[model samples]
Target: MFDNVGYRPGRKPQNATQEAIFAFHVALRTGMRSGEVLQLGARTLDVGRRVAVVEHKTQRYTGKPRRVPLLSPAVRLLKPFAVQERIFTIDDADRDALFRKVRDRLMLKHLDFHDSRATALTHMSRKVPVQVLSRISGHKDIRILVNRYYRESAEDIAKRFA
Candidate 1:
């Protein structure tokens, strides 16, 4: 679990870790899957247009391209780390290792790599409609977004009813 696994605490990441953190933050803020974020290339980001084209891992449903509007936070985090060829590139094993390291460092429990996408979707859904959120997240089916990504709490329900 994340809270129990203490790899590093209150310490900044070194060279590679910093880049990994930047990539993770971009995925977190932009509602992008880890694979999508990792697949990003320099040509994928159009800063003048403020849009990023992400190629989904599973192209069976959503096709090849999904445009994501870059938030200022995501842009700022990624700008310095961007490379000429790829924004972020790590093999599946390395990606998982990096996520584990980040989870341990942050003292987060039960957080998996895919959880970042869910977290981003949940956060975005609070401010946007399910349809809009689905579009932004490149989910063709709203059911996937609602059933899997959005986590509603008892406190929220009670507040709504109150």
Candidate 2:
């Protein structure tokens, strides 16, 4: 949806649509859930270290903080918002409503807001080992990572062999 009509990448957001687009880009880059991205605050980001330590959904179960490695691309996108208390001002309900309208307009009704995490992990899986990906995703079970989020197509897999 970032490529859709309203999104303007690389520029500071000027309006609500641009802000939502920016949030989605953060989620895509950091492999963070929509709520996590919306809740992201300046305090959570460690730009010097290129990582963001976030309190995630699984934090209560594992009793460990989630450390999300921020690649250069993600850092660039996040730099402008580093001084703000909250990166994206929209709440989950608003974010959901925005995404719903975008998806409906874009004919992407099948897309879910949470799909960004899965998509990010799938792309990251190609560059990092499963163990590393597991760490980034905060998934204690490798099986969950493999079974649920690592969604490389069979055609893509065959291309690797070829």
Best candidate according to TM-score: 2
TM per model?
0.76, 0.89
Model 1 TM-score, 2 decimals: 0.76
Regions more than 4 Å wrong, model 2: 2-5
Per-residue C-alpha lDDT of model 1 across residues 1-162, encoded as one tens digit per residue: 222332132233344554466556667878887777877667787766667887776676656677887767666655654444675556556777876787777777577777778888787777788888888888777998888988878797587668
Task: Quote the lDDT for 85 in model 2.
Answer: 82
What is the C-alpha lDDT profile of model 2 across 1-162, one tens digit per residue? 666745667666666666776777788888888777876768888888888878778778879778888878889888877777877777778878877788789898898877888999999998999999988887889999899888999999899889
Identify the candidate with maximal lDDT. 2
Q: Each prediction's Cα lDDT score?
A: 0.69, 0.80
Model 2, residue 114: what's the lDDT?
Answer: 76
